[model samples]
Target: MTFAEITTKRGDASDGMATGPLGRAHVRADGPAKITGRATYALEHAVADALHCVIVQSTIGAGRVVSIDKSDAEASPGVHLVLDAGNSLPLVPKADFFGNLPPGDTFVPFATEIRHNGELVAAVVADTVEQARAAADRLHITYEEAPVVATFADPRAGDGNPVEAMSKTWGEAEQALAEAPVSIEVRYETPREYNVPIEPHGLIAHWEADDRLTIHEPSQWIDGMANQFATWFGIPFENVRVVSPYIGGGFGSKGQALPHSAVAATAARMLGRPVKLAVTRPQTFTAHGGRPATWQTLKIGASEDGRIVAIDHRGANETAAAANFVETLGVVTSMMYAVPNFRSRQTIVPVNTVVPGAFRAPGKNPSAFALESAMDELAIALGMDPVELRRRNEPDVDPENGKPWSSRRLLACYDAGAAAFGWSKRNPEPRSMRNGRQLVGWGMAVGTHPVYSSPGEAMVRVLANGRVEVLSSAIDMGTGTYTILAQTAADALGVPVERVEVKLGDSRLPRAPVAGGSQLANLMVGAVHKTALAAREDLIALGLSDPNSPLQNQANTLIIEDGMIGPPRGPAIPLGDLLTATGRDALEVTRDTLPEKERTAEERLSMFTSLAGMERGPGIPKSRHSFCAHFVEVLVDEDFGTVRVSRVVSAVDAGRLYNPKLADSQFKGGIIMGIGMALLEEGITDPRNGRILNANLADYLIATNADIPAIETISVGEPDYDATPLGGKAVGEVAIVGMAAAIANAVHHAAGKRIRDLPITMEKLL
Candidate 1:
């Protein structure tokens, strides 16, 4: 399917060609509002007669509630109502994975069953947040505790159904491993991690009538939330509206409509007043989704020359018993390198914990940590440079399915990043390079993420005043979606970006896919491109039909530039003049853009069949993925076991960059998060009670400004037209996928101790 070609020649001198908005650096459009504190988040939404709600949670991870006594709480001053399971409205049951509802049990306030620690058991609504918190603390609750498995190592964790794709084999990996000249078997583990977005989960729900509801939420998927709310309340989908114009961050946590949203909405309808509920930071640890802890065993066999012959990866991840969301840990192993005999498995261990969901890069993050580290270990055993080892195994096509990459410049990324990070000067011997008391070590790793795009709709309108407006329901999540959309519209419509206004984050706008999986920019921008083309064509048609127009019948000769419509050699007239002559206030067009159905169908079939451990067919089909490479320099204190990242250089091949500034920001953000994952961040749980031990910011460690060092991001190659009209793939997730592996590899080079577990803490090194 060919789209309207919108080209930006590198050195064009036309008045409309102002350096082309693509591949340029620009300040974020929302920067002023954000810095000045004028931006309103979900919890900041104000409504008349809005009440505050505080949820009361269960102390036990698994249990049945005996009784809830709310007498003192209900009688407290300023308390409006105390609601429990017996009094609160019943909600529809949650569906399977990727459902509209959150990935957990349905919201049953004060329910008999407590599925996990910190499960909401009741709620108190009052005149203010303080009063609600005060009253909620006064409620008395009792529970009948039940035995629970809190970790993947527990024998009972294997009671759930085995994930079908957890175990698969393409050839006789065992025999190949035994015959190989060199082999290594290693184990790696990563602790559970939380998606601690700066803004906690919050919702402000208002019911205009019994059937009409409006909710302000920090939701990454407003459409999904609207659908879930409508279904739960038995109302028309159109009657439920979600507004989330600004979100501090999501990182995959706020994408679903959690139980709290329904509880708040139900309370608002019952009281005939708006209710605002914001989960405290502590509640976010257990209430919202997180990355599950994983344990992996990797067995790799290589020839004497460092060519891998057989690869085996087996892993298990913790998950809530109610959720079937298995992290795709083994999926990356099949695509990373060229190996004839390969086997991979990912087991889902049911543990008493919060349901695990997609944290940025999800499966690929932990998988890369295991696979890439193993590659380094194999490189060491084979006495070869790590980079050369990877180069030797680089597949001309996808190893698993024999598919040609739409665009894979992973090799180029390594080349560019290695040169920038001075990888040539590194010593192969461990603990050899040092800077005084700190051991200096350099490491590199390759990163990749599947290119994902979904159908999306967008509306474009050219007003009588010659201003253009692009509308969609996509979210920003601080990733600069608004800025990029404006750039796309400005470039497509031949207007200054300042004159093009982009509106988003409302369910009433054109439909858009969820703003996760790094797909929102490509999907929404493609829709806008199509919409702008339709609107431009409509303007030309209007000018040709207008009697007052000079080129009334020369539609083919017309050129639209800088809001002016005219023939290339004739007098030009403002677009407003043409609209005025046509007696129209605005020309509007809406378009829905979908991925190529045949290609999508083929890819889906291949993915599912491969997951089922079936044999792949012959021939090299088209494959799509974003690639990246990270070169990290870490300074490890030989005596104290303190590891500090000194420098990082990342080269990415994500196709065309709409805004280099925003892209660099995203790269840096991902790298910072990766540093946290490798050195400091871990969700600690109390084994005795299955409760999060350190849920607050003060206790839980993330990479702060003081922890970050110099980070350099380089964009590689031209835009890939085969991937999307914008010629871009996802950059949001890939940067972090291989980061931890790189850092861990550097630690091995510095300390000679190969710690396979994450957060490479001092205790382990000591």
Candidate 2:
């Protein structure tokens, strides 16, 4: 395999020409397939004589299973097998740090002990889906219920220790607060939230003979899934094959291989037949994971001039006793602004509930709401403009580690958003703006998220027909990944975008990281860029070595464009003709963009210095984060306590825009989710037994088209060449970071009510 490396540094003139289809607004290449129903999601795959499986969940939150009666279910019509702890295949415990597993209890299949309600207890396999579901419902199980700590308010919830990595302090914030002229302390609470991607979790497993296994599932990380399946089944990694060409949506929940996947595979091997499992929407709430609820306290101290002098943020979040996943909500404040004295800490609260996982922006979303809303309250105390107060507190460098920013354009975003939003015309007083029996108010907040790059590999092949194929294992979770990769290849090869095809979502292809953390674009694009460059070099070598070539020794003066190779200003020959003359069918090159393992000591130190205060290492001197500003206008009905957002304008400085149309769509989608976070979405749990009360869409609320407002997104400036080859930063998470805060601020401005809790429901307002 040939390798080409791309080191992150200042880009040159060739970078400009390679920006061919980058900024252009192109439609998603996978859109037609999706809308026309040609794309195959996980459960959509059809296999002949496939058995269906339905899992039975425990009714008790905490206890030990005493008795299981499966005779009734096994005797039902079309039933194949009933797998319980006594009959199910033995499985190994999850290894530490595998598939992002926290340091706590591992998920064991068909375990006799129950840690929470809805824990998988048994699996029923039948000839048809209906039979499997019916049989599963017929199974009778009994358990010994134990006293449970089911809520965040329970006295036992605070038994866990603090997360040391997330705790940081610069100076004495208490002293600064005591001496400041103005100070405000506020607490904010957010409810648990679910991912709820359109397509629920599903998987199909087939065992060929006894050593080989194949799975069709929607996973954001196929490579990791393959490794996990291999380890669990005691098979070689090469014998386990995972295929996931198209994922409906993940939002981080589908990134790992859950417990049900193991059950489906185990059942298939036992029966010597293919088995399919489709997790129902209601089951998704407990079977997979969701974001944990958070309680945050923020204290700020400011001078008379509205400049922040001290800040302290602390968060307590609920996690399942089975997993040690703590929401580090306070970390977002470390890079948000400049404060001389700052402190942040995170403490986990263990409760007998479903294990929490990452949802969209993860810790940043809830923390931003707390931090920005507290800033709004502080502005009110100081009698200063909210936007002006934020601008005055913008840090010249990262406040925690005294590191310079790779690219800090948050002020630019604020200026652009304020200008576009017409912020100067707004009245300062709350309840002063009105529209036909409704109160109108405007609010704005800052958004920031970390930028990171992981190792990945890609392969580029130039065929005899002058077509290009770029291959990787990256998943396209309806985020326009396919379209962006196509554009990147087209630009690099100097060919039409349509002539380039991108093949992804298969572990057989070159390896790539999971499509989470907003790192997919940067990683994949860098790999593709290096692969294409290497292929170009191979083509030039082949052309120069052939005596029949147009100009034998003019390689130094040759120009490759539009699939043609020729002298600087002479007759050109098609790449296919040159390949035919050289007796070659196609040319292929592979490149791997590994982490900075091979860099010199100074280079590594410099790289770490840029990522200081992010837990990367010590002695780092700079920080890299994407920034955005969300401005919103809301209409409040004082009579009914109803709040409706009428308009939103989001200005972002996330390096460069890969495709403005798709980027705008991502921004709107994230903002819509933010609106849901602010005014709608909440996952309720019954305190009596620790069961999720709102497990289905009918009970759990999300924003609909009727509830959304007119959203506009703006890009602040040119690319940040220091970020990546494409000069773009991560855009997926930042759009929603500060959205809830902005909406809550607007609500306070209109109604003169400071609702610290999330979902600012009518009941709370009234």
lDDT, residue 107, candidate 1:
51
Q: What's model 2's TM-score? A: 0.94
Query: Which residue pairs show backbone clashes in model 1?
Result: 110-121
lDDT of 2 at 191: 95
Least accurate 10 contiguous residues by lDDT in model 1:
608-617
RMSD of 1: 4.9
Q: How do all models score by TM-score?
A: 0.93, 0.94
Stretches of candidate 1 exceeding 4 Å from the true structure:
1-19, 94-110, 159-161, 548-551, 595-621
Per-residue CA lDDT of candidate 1, range 1-766, in tens?
Answer: 0011122233332223136664556677776677778889988887989999988878998988899999999999899889888898876665423533443445553446877788888999999999999999999998999987778867867745566765777888999999999999999999989889999997999999899999999878777677778877888777988999889989989777887887899889889999999999999887766899988899999999998999988888887865666887877788999899999877788788877888998898899999999999999999999999998998888777777887888889889999999999999999999999999888888888877766677898888887788888788889988888887777777776777888888888877767777878887778888888788888787777767665698646677887788987788888777887777888889877643434464343222111111112232246778888899999999889999999999999887777777888888999999999999999888776788889999888999999899999988845777676778888788899889999999998999988899989988987
lDDT of each: 0.82, 0.82
For candidate 2, the lDDT comes to 0.82
